[model samples]
Target: MTDKQRTDRGTREYRMGELAERAGITVRTLRFYRERGLIPPPRREGRIAWYDDHHLARLRTIAALLERGHTLSGIADLASAFDSGRDVGEVLGLGEPSEETPVRLTPEALSDYFEGETTAENLSAALDLGYLATDGDELVHISRRLLDVSSALVKEGVPLSAVLAAGREVRGHAEALASLFVELLRPHAAEGDLQRLRPLAKSVVDAELSLALDRRLRGS
Candidate 1:
């Protein structure tokens, strides 16, 4: 890998030995993690398994969790939960996420995404906020829309910290909106109806927020 590529944390394919070296783990430990289902199975090409950046990210996350006082079993569970999207879907009960795929960012890539606002303190804060999770050497964001919006705000001269703070406030409001919709739907709506009608809540919020912004800009 070139210096730029090595530092950028974008896509790269690796053999078993290379993956272990990149992740700073021994081959045996890598194998053990695979056995424990911490990392997904690699693509098979004949007899050789090919690992990718995703696997590397996961390995780095496991290491970070270990440093954070998580046992292997706990990390395993966390990995499984995140990978399965169960935490995002069920535990959070947020219904379908916005029409955006998850984003996996390396620390460096995340800096690039947020325009160098990714300080160590901010990173730790993001981890604490559950907005980010470490995987081997990458950060996993569960929502592409959120990542894009935060980065856009940073580009517009908003501080990353401020954006995150706003996100925290927005989370409360979002939960309230969700609860309102659920309660409103519960009496006559079936589960499928609840799912189908969820978007109406977001649409109402979006339209109202647009009008609010328009009024504010017009000094009304």
Candidate 2:
């Protein structure tokens, strides 16, 4: 609490093992993260890696986010926000603001995770559609319902990237569709018409989505 107390407490630099223990992750996992480009290579003292509190902080943050189900790639975007000195408001789609913490992932690994015909593209598309995000080196589905939908699609041999790409491509069209409806309903509106029409808006959305599927089936 005083200047002398502050002076007495000095920074402690830890070796990889100690840092990993403090961060509640294995040393090997830390190394794996380094190899995956999720973490920076530690400082070396004659072939021995040394980590500081900063590294520990980053690891703790990663663990927390992962526990919260954020994928590594999504975490990376959130981390970038912090690196650029962005506030929590800029990073989290939230109600309150908090100080930024480090959250990151390797982009290459992310691309690789969804690369090939397996489902990388769809996974990437899921990320774009806000279905996925990085927690460290992991990808997370923000919506459990969406995750189930994606899983079903994957079972059908539909790549995640295609879905994500389609979502991205369709976003503009969706917005335009919404704009058209908003205008159409605007004419019959009252001062707090939005409140009265909230349930109707949901119904309209359901109808629109169903119509889209019906159109696709008919076309096929």
Candidate 3:
């Protein structure tokens, strides 16, 4: 067994031929994708090249995208956007969401969530909105609630692009609301009290939004 076959952490590694076979592609095609920058460069141990599960996952994602009628150039752009997007830690910053559950997803699974709407532009927009962050080769949606809501909206014939635009708008309002609440409580409440009372703020917003939606519907 060559050093290239295994890593220090015991991760499975494959040589080019083995990886190509596992990915159901020819070595030549794999090299072509590499040359085109569709995939990241493989780890090299002197003359031997090592590919790991991340590389395999990427290859499978590329194949799936191709099956979905995505052009090679488009796939390259998506790959670039995915690679450059912020990671989970950066998105969360100092504190994790106290109430919202985070959901981790593979790239293919995320495509399944949004169906044919997982374009490079949409991916970049989601990243910008802080809805998605990369964790290694996987993606972490900041909130399972948001993920479910977005997926349901898409199922209801809302375009992902439009949903993302609405989310961007909502984010601004949400931040402003948060600031307002913090300002209102800061003089009277300690930091710990503010943290503990967050659900009260959420409740106020939820009730108000429901009433606002009712008013809008009645007006319409």
Candidate 4:
């Protein structure tokens, strides 16, 4: 807002500079995003334009999708699709469902994360395991936890191939555990209640795993 442009009674307004600062982007970049239709048109008061919290939220969402390996064109398409009230499942076209946050990385960045272990064969294996999806020049890891754990294991001298094989085994056990918990909940709980109580299964698993580790360390 210009110094002359005061708040219009009910709605809060911010100047371009203020909006740019809030979004952590330069004015030039903000303008570029606007031109690309990545952000909505701001309300204009004569020559000055004013932005609001909605603009800030859109900017943050864009940043998150970018971090998750969406190209600008793809983000634009998603934004348009979401704005049009399309189903999220349709917009993504994901092969497998996942609740974990995805991590996006370039080929070089992926190599760095895995300590130079992102070989062609390992990449193929990851794709086959549904642990990775390609988005233009980026690779998106289906689960951030899996990506971090795999990278850490590689750093600890585990071969990438072995880590991937372990991941496959863990996937089978994880699915069985999930099925067991769902079966336990199906007859006794409402869907909403089951969703709310989902963390209980994780707590049980964590406790049991800890005890199992203790027993193994004690050779019992």
Q: Which candidate number has the best TM-score? A: 3
* Segments of candidate 2 deviating more than 4 angstroms: 1-14, 20-36, 41-129, 133-142, 208-212, 215-219
* Residue-level lDDT tens digits of model 4 in 41-143: 9988688788876677777767765665557776565445334332223324655443678777654466567754555567667776767766533567777
lDDT digits (tens) for residues 57-132 of candidate 1: 7788678656655577766665554453323333224543456466777544565686557554556556656677
lDDT of 2: 0.56
lDDT of each: 0.72, 0.56, 0.91, 0.72
Structural similarity to truth (TM-score) of each candidate: 0.57, 0.50, 0.92, 0.56
Counting clashing residue pairs in each candidate, in order, gives 7, 21, 0, 1
RMSD of 2: 8.8
Candidate 2 to truth, TM: 0.50
Residue 110 in model 2: shift from native, Å?
11
**C-alpha root-mean-square deviation, candidate 4:** 10.8
* Clash pairs detected, candidate 3: none
Q: Taking the tens digit of each residue's C-alpha lDDT, what string does model 3 give over 69-116?
A: 778998898898889999899999987898889999987788889988
- Candidate 3 root-mean-square deviation in Å: 1.8
Between 3 and 4, whose TM-score is larger? 3
lDDT of 1: 0.72
